[model samples]
Structures are given as C-alpha cells and as structure tokens.
Target: MTTRADGRKILVVGVGGLGRAVVEEALDRGAEVSVLVRDPDKLARSVDVRRLAAVTVGDGTDPATLDRAVAGVDVVVSGNGAHKRMAREIARAVKRNGVQKLIWPAGGTNAFADDGVTPAYKLHEGRFPGARDIYLAHQGCIDAIRQVGVNHVIWAPGRMTARGARSRDIEVKVDRSAGMYVSYEDAAWVIVEAAVTDAWDGHLVSAATQTGG
Candidate 1:
C-alpha cells in the first residue's frame, strides 16, 4: 500500500453523498478526478472545483453516457445507486474500453448467507421493502461483472456510522457477523484502496473495524 500522489486519471460516477466522499478521497490522493453527474450546477456549488478534471452531466445508466465518461480513464470508481443500472453500464463500459480496474458498491447481506441473522436484516428489510430490492440489484450487478470478466472490486460494508478514524487495519470477510460494523469514511477509503491496489484484483472485500486492535 503505497498511498502516493500519482495523479492517475479516475472517473467517479455520482457526485452525491457517498459519491462526494469518494471524489474527495480521490482528489485527496492526487488523482485526476472526473465525475458523471446529472446536475452540474449543484455539483459545482457543492464540490471543490480545483480538483475536478472534467464533468459529464447525464444519467450514468446509459451506455453512451458511460462511454463518454469513461473515455481515456485508467480506473473508474462508481458511487451510483441501484435505480439507474449504473453498475451494469459501468461494467459494460469497462469491458468496452478495455479498462481493467473497476470498483462499485454492493450489499453486505448479499455477500453473506442467512446464517440466522436474516431475521435482523429482515427487520430492516421489512421497514424498507426496497432494502432487499437494492441488495438483489447489487447481486445482479456482481453476476454481470463476473460474467463480463473485468478486473473489479465489489465493496460490501456492514452497519456504518459517519467518519471515525482512518486506519488500514480493517477486517475483510466473506461471511457476515452480528458484531461487524464499519465507519462510512473507512468503508469509502477501503473501496478506494482496493480499487487502486494491484493485490485486490477480481476480489470482493468487505469492510469492518479491526477488533481488539
């Protein structure tokens, strides 16, 4: 893990809350960051313009739109949501453009089986019917990416709070635990790290705080 200021070209597709954090981290890491946003005025007012290399304003789900956003990009880290099929188009464009590195968000539930805690997940599942829907959509995105055979990383983080401390000493697991949780900022950092690292190619990594560290 060399967190260097290499100024690599990176495209982040969504400039909202979570996406904003990703864009900030990418800029903090000295990458040439571009964003695909639906509203440029909002983004310009919201984001630090000095760090933005370019902005493609459109719905990221469209193949042509994604193609334009990803053109000449080395790596693409997406914060797009379940509604717009952003993951699907990102995968397709990554394949089309011969860009190997792609990182997108998935759900912690889908990464782990019901192991009896489906009850708790189901509690939230009931409150929001779309919880399960969103998870399923992420699963579909995972399947699509795997089938497409692109170099990718899918991040699934457990129950999260806002920013805590930044530590690379985080837990990564394929199975869910009742005790597992992560900070939102830490999760975003993990996604950025895994996206840039050569060691995590084609791997799905879950983020959690280091226990008893």
Candidate 2:
C-alpha cells in the first residue's frame, strides 16, 4: 500500500544526507514540505528550493529559529545527529509550538530498546578511536527527546550504506538487536513513512535491510 501525505505540513531539520532523502521522500508522497537549514545556499545547490513550502535559514540550536520553523507544522522530522544541544533546542520548540508528531533518527550509538552496546556502536568505536565522548553526546540528545513527552518515534538504523537502492525487504524491529546494515534510502523511506502515518508512533524502532541493500 502506498502511504500518502497529502495536505500534511512537514518541517525537516538539517538537510544533510538523511535530511535530503527525507525531503525527497515526503515530497514524492505528496506532502507540503519545508526545511530548516543553516545554509540555504547549500540546500539550494542540492535540492530544488522552489518546490518547498518554506525554507527557514538558521541553526537548529537556536530557539528563535526553531520557533519560527515549527510554527503551524503538523510534523517535525529531525535529520540531525550527534548534537545533543541541537536536539534539546528542537524539543523545546516542539513543545512550545504544540506540534504533536516528531520523527527523529537515533544517534548511531544510542540504543532505544536496551542499555546494552550494539554492533553499530562497536563499528563506530573501531573506525574512530577516542570517539566515545561524541557517541555519548548524541545519546544525550535521545535522552532529551524522551523527556520532552511528545508523541514521537525514534528510527534507529545501523550502518547506513549509500551504495544501493532501497529494498522492500527492510525489517522494522522493536528489539534493538537487529542487523547492522541498511541503505540510506531505506532508512529515509521508513522515517518519512512514519511521519505521515501513525504506524510507529510513540515507539523506538530499529530498521535494517535484510540483504545489506
């Protein structure tokens, strides 16, 4: 079944790789889309800014900027990661604006189900030694979101690949222990799908592609 987002207002924060994908998927699903980007020029270079409902230029950590961005929006999709301060600011804006639905990707190391370490965390630790502090900082963002008391979904994806097409065989698991590889496209699809629908509302979902695609 095709999920439609027609007439819904969505605000996408941080138009990076993941953010860009979310915007595209949401647009494809017929949603009215807007973006909160620090660098409007950079976002324009990558995406057709004219297709967006609105584009607000400011840092995600700024309350004033977030307040403006979250105004009159139905759902807020956060594409930011590893920045606890930014996440806290977004949560505050969500509460202030009374936006009910929020969809955020978990920090690569943060586990939504249990406190145990995950393969994705070990992968990051091995790739970049002395990065434990960075992981903890991102995890702090997830903690902040949980305390905000908003209807939200945290889509936890493992090592994301940019090399393959999205697979329908992707799995959404409630358990944190799942496969450690998923395509960026698939992860983005799941995030946007959850934003438009209530399938994963108020839950922490771990998603991964079955065949590494």
Candidate 3:
C-alpha cells in the first residue's frame, strides 16, 4: 500500500516500544521523521538516531519543547501513553502550529463496541477499580483533539504484545470488533498507514491482527 508519507515531515513523541516501531515504519516509508524524547541518550542507544531528521530533547508536557518539535511538521503521531495532560499539551501544540494531522493511540476501551458498550470499558468498570478515571481521561484527550478541528485518527489497539514479527494480514474495524491482541509492530504499521491516509481520518479505528496468519 502506498502510504503517501514520502518526503513528509512527521513528528513522533515518545520513543518507547510502540513509538520506536512507528519511527522505524515512518522512516521505511520515506518520511522525514523527527522525535521528541525525554532521554536522548537512551533513544540513541536503541536506534541509529543519526538517521533521524532531528531529535529534540525535552518533556512532552513542556509547551516550549512541543512548540519546537511540532514546527513545520505535516503530521504528529503521539504514543506517549495515556496521560491526559500530555495529550492535551500535544493537541494544543498541533493546533497552535496548524498541523493538519494527528494520530493518537487511544486504548480499546475508548472504541465503542458493537453491542453499544465497550467490552474493555465494562471490564474496567466491573473488575478494575479506579480504572474508569483513566478511561475518562483518555476521553478528555479525544475531546481536545476533536475540539481543535484538526484531521485526526484515534487508533485503538486493545492488547498489544511487546515484541513479535510483523503480520502481513491485519484487521481494522470502525467498531470494537477487531481481535483482542496485536503485535507492537503490526500496531505501528497500522498507525503509520492511518497517519498518511484519509480513509480513517476524523474517525476512531480498532485494529488487531488476524488469527492464524
């Protein structure tokens, strides 16, 4: 599939497992990629940081750092965990900088299920105490993105494995009916594809690997 990321300036916040996968895929697709990280040395040790277009060191919540990172970017892909404050800050920066696209990883619970109730959300409510707060916070982040009026895609990959080979076949659903778990690599592929494509723009997609693939 043609991602249309060639020569595009893409900013990735948080270079952890999923973030690293995103960076690699974005680079593979020929995007001019930059990363914003708190620990430049740690990221340097993991990947060939020298290949990146730029690497700015600072906290994601820092407005000045975000401003610097977001400048002149075509799209922003943030895999900075579930911190509402960080999401808010990134959304603000994207809007303030007039970036056109934002791709965020909102958990499976955030995607509405076919039965009209998100299964993970019900699980959090029924079993995990205080987990609802996290869900609500993620919702707040989604709200911020929507309120900003930028074209966005919220990727909801429910349960993800830390390491695995990338799958050639994957499934993506607008509803929460996709598979339960996907490899980090596969999730990253979906995210990068979504970032550069308009198929899922202004929508939330649930992505997972196909079984027995």
Per candidate, the number of residue pairs that clash is: 0, 0, 0
**Which scores higher on lDDT, 1 or 3?**
3
Clashing pairs in 1: none
Cα RMSDs, all models: 3.9, 3.0, 2.2
Better of 1 and 2 by lDDT: 2
lDDT, candidate 1, 111-140, per-residue tens: 554463452235457666766776777678
Candidate 3 worst ten-residue window by lDDT: 116-125
Candidate 2 local lDDT, 62-125, one digit each (tens): 9999999999999999988767787777888898899978787774455433445453465567
Model 3 vs. true fold: TM:
0.90
Residue range 1-213, candidate 3, lDDT tens digits:
646579989999999888888898889899999999999988998769977999989999899999999999989999675777787788889999999888988777777767757545665566767557766767778887777677888887777875556776788887464755777888888888887878888878887877542
Candidate 1: 10-residue stretch with minimal lDDT: 113-122
Please report, as a residue range, the 10-residue window in candidate 2 with the lowest summed lDDT: 111-120
Off by over 4 Å in 3: 2-4, 116-120, 123-131, 211-213
Question: In candidate 3, how many Å is residue 157 off?
Answer: 1.3
**Candidate 2 has what TM-score?**
0.86
